[model samples]
Target chain A: EAGVAQSPRYKIIEKRQSVAFWCNPISGHATLYWYQQILGQGPKLLIQFQNNGVVDDSQLPKDRFSAERLKGVDSTLKIQPAKLEDSAVYLCASSLVGGSEQYFGPGTRLTVT
Target chain B: QQPVQSPQAVILREGEDAVINCSSSKALYSVHWYRQKHGEAPVFLMILLKGGEQKGHEKISASFNEKKQQSSLYLTASQLSYSGTYFCGTEGAGSYQLTFGKGTKLSVIP
Candidate 1:
């Protein structure tokens, strides 16, 4: 079985520029999540979607970050006017249902200079 | 909120054993473990559900104590492959988010 897939494995952009990351979850998974992992730190939950409807985004930086899972299969996470601190690995994961072990993607490494 | 992990870092010789703990203030319904190599996405290790159940792969085990709202990852007779940063992600009751602990870096020297 194929695992979670993500595109643009590495990215480099200047501060104040816009960047977007894409993710394709595992087949048949219903819950998708976006997480930001900084250097030397664990991935921090940014948003979660249950069948295209957000289940939790309390930690998302609304002013600069946005994500959507259209049709509940593929998802995109965008950051406009990126800041230096936004330079981190953006990971996408998916699970079976309400509670299950998540499968992670290779992650898109964003470098905001 | 993020969970707290103990022994921020540990160094072990081959064939030794080590334990990493993760504690959360909020009641957890499930605890997930992952091992990440430097610059790579974390790989799923195991998940321990509530009711004090333990589940894991060969040589790597974990225990979840619902009463204590904590979980521990155990690596027995460690090998070089066990060297990496270990993180515990916990899902609280009624919440979909899986808050992760900072991490525990383990170095197993041969």
Candidate 2:
């Protein structure tokens, strides 16, 4: 079976610029998630979607970051006015159901200069 | 809240054994383990629920103690491929979100 898929394996943007990442989760998966992984740290949950509906996004910085999963299959995460601190890998994952084993994508390495 | 992992890093020769521990302050519903190589996404290792069950995958295994809110990952007769950062993610009761620990860096030298 195919695993989760993400676009632009790497990205670089200037500070204050906007950037967007895309993800297509495994077919038939019911839960999708977005995470930010910094160097030497574990992936931090940014948001979660359960069939196109948000399940949790408490850790997300609403002032600069936003994400949406349309049709419960494809999802996008956007960051506006990116900060240098936002330079990290953006990972997309999907699971058969909530609280189940997750499959992650290649991830987009975003570097804000 | 984020869980705490012990032994921030460990180096072992192939065929040796190693254990990584994770502890959470809040009541846990489940614990998930993953291994991530440099520049690669994390790969799911196993998941243990609130029943205090133990699960194994190949030479790697894990045990969850719901009462203590702690989990331990065991690698027996470790292989070179076991070199990676191990992360433990915890899920609280009635919550689907997973808060991951800082990770334990394990290096297996041949």
Displacement of residue B57 (Cα, Å) in model 2 is 2.2
True contacts kept of each: 0.79, 0.95
The digit string of per-residue lDDT tens for model 2 on A47-93 reads: 99999999999999999999999989999999998999999999999
Q: What is the C-alpha lDDT of each candidate?
A: 0.93, 0.97
Computed on C-alpha atoms, the DockQ of candidate 1 is 0.81
Q: Please write out the lDDT profile of model 2 over residues B33-103, one tens digit for every residue.
A: 99999889999999999999999978999999999999999999999999999999999999988999999
User: Model 1 over residues A1-113: C-alpha lDDT tens digits?
Assistant: 99999999999999999999999999999999999999889999999999999998999999999999999999999999899999999999999985688889999999999
Candidate 1 lDDT over residue span B37-79, tens digit each: 8877899899888899987688999999999999999999999
Top model by lDDT, which number? Answer: 2
Q: Itemize residue pairs with steric clashes in candidate 2.
A: none
What TM-score does candidate 1 reach? Answer: 0.97
Candidate 1 ranges beyond 4 A from true positions: none
lDDT of 2: 0.97
Complex DockQ per candidate: 0.81, 0.95
Q: Candidate 2, which segments miss by more than 4 Å at Cα?
A: none
